[model samples]
Target: MSTAALITLVRSGGNQLRRRVLLSSRLLQDDRQVTSTCNSSTSEPRCSRFDPDGSGRPATWDSFGIWDNRIDEPILLPPSIKYGKPIPKISLENVGCASQIGKRKENEDRFDFAQLTDEVLYFAVYDGHGGPAAADFCHTHMEKCITDLLPKEKNLETVLTLAFLAIDKAFSSHARLSADATLLTSGTTATVALLRDGIELVVASVGDSRAILCRKGKPMKLTIDHTPERKDEKERIKKCGGFVAWNSLGQPHVNGRLAMTRSIGDLDLKTSGVIAEPETKRIKLHHADDSFLVLTTDGINFMVNSQEICDFVNQCHDPNEAAHAVTEQAIQYGTEDNSTAVVVPFGAWGKYKNSEINFSFSRSFTSSGRWA
Candidate 1:
């Protein structure tokens, strides 16, 4: 494989692109029918999405940083084998996602979901560091590994833990077979959400990417970001004979290399407490007033707070549009990293298609209204 092929490998298809469009603009009824018209008969439903193609440049994307040496010389790669299939079925009851390559030449973000059964659904987001390989690998293989190990487990947390470590070990085996030491360096953060019975949500996360729950329009955090700057993380790194400090970029990193202490494939940093163990959380959904859930990488979280993000999502009835709103807001706020957002709505929020609603986001933390 060459660099161009590698780029295509990771950047090509969304398999779930249709689901994003469907859920981002329409609402699923109790009877399994979807409607975008909501309760209004006068106005047309907003179905347009914010897709970044070769079109007009977004003002937020700085013009100076979009090229790289890989454009001319495509590096040769070893023969590749197809990864596990994307979840055979989609549980598009109420889920949405949006991602932007931002100023980078290649996008390292990947997200998808699978409906294991009628009542069980799995969602994931992977943010790659160093390159898109690790992210793509996790996005393609993590859930498959999870489902394969599902029947043997009784505890959700234990299952999630096993799945993550299993992926780490599989990647290690692949690296050895391919003789690709680079795989050990290219790592990604994994954030997976499991929705059982449509009301019970279990999230497993490693690294800075987060999952936030919006209950009655309030932001409730579900996962803790695994950054080296955190006190416990810093102490743990020290215990492992590693140091944490701000690099020239003004960001914290362990051993001046990897920033997040926990990830899927950063094998080089694993000795320094950079393990793949994921933190898990369970959330019970309330149908009357409880709203959607938002999962995003640090790109969005760095620019927007949980409260403001929840407020923005509350304004968009469609989860995809909600995700787009979050990412667009992050870019507008000048978040330079590649941004991605996943919105999963339930209960009243699943059908709150108030078409006339529009919202503006705040660049800084003030309070939580739609008036930034």
Candidate 2:
């Protein structure tokens, strides 16, 4: 296979292979410390400790390894569906697997949502690259920033822009800790979506995480990936005194450090103009065509596309089941990163709202029939 193909395979398939190797090796041998060297000489600050010859102990788990353990913990989400006209029914799921790389556990991803009022639904997905701090921060603060921007009229575009800026400011301020403070080098890609009046959807994003809308049997992309090697992204990086380099794997990375143009909380790279503010977009929801929304990190994109996921969801009767299947597929295909997904069905709002109409009991739907 070509170098590019090999790199893609390693990224997509390496996690599971690595996990099996690690587990089997541990079972056969009592030592848990497995040392491996990266192909690149210029290592990311976060992964440096994992480098065999680096200053840190040879066996110390790197960010990726640390993340593997973190993924075993259950995902936490804020309260949602408080009060909304035609309240939306939400379903989300996440899973972690070690598929390809035998060395470190690097991928981290999360999603959270909150219903601030009767007309607005705020949600966000964070895909961590170097570590989990950035994604975790986004998951915690996304709702607050978005809700702060919501006006009486509910303009998603304006709110998204303001929210992105606010998040950047918040991250910058947090990064300015004293030199003696202990800090972990971490960052994450983020995407935020807001649904208003049950029709308008607004999305804002930075880095490689994505948001997709399934409308009229067609999948539409709502956010752009700010990859380092993309022409526009390259230009922006070069303008900011940074250079993109091709690693032994032939993948584009910023100064052999990062792979994206925008992200949240890479304190080390912030000086190179890697801002956390997201690019924003707005779209009107269509009832006749719109079916569901899929939000995920780069793990899903490594093996499949939006259409593939949409088709999988089409086969399922329940959104939650669809989410489980998608995560399973990502694992089977070899996504090295911690795979996380949030699936939201479009038409479930009507049923959810109807339940609220009758206060005596809460109604739910099953594959066979509706239940009261």
Which has the greatest lDDT? 1
lDDT of 2 by residue, 92-208 (tens): 232111112212365467777668665677767787766566676777787877766676335677777777777766765675653523233578888888877556788889898
lDDT of 1 by residue, 105-196 (tens): 88899888777655568888899988887898898888788787778885677889999999988887776676666877889999999876
User: Candidate 1, 104: how far from true, in Å?
Assistant: 1.1
RMSD for all candidates, in order, please: 17.3, 27.1
What is the overall TM-score of model 1 with all chains considered together? 0.70
Q: What is the lDDT of residue 137 in candidate 1?
A: 83
| Model 1 lowest lDDT segment of ten | 61-70
Residue 180, candidate 1: alpha-carbon lDDT:
67
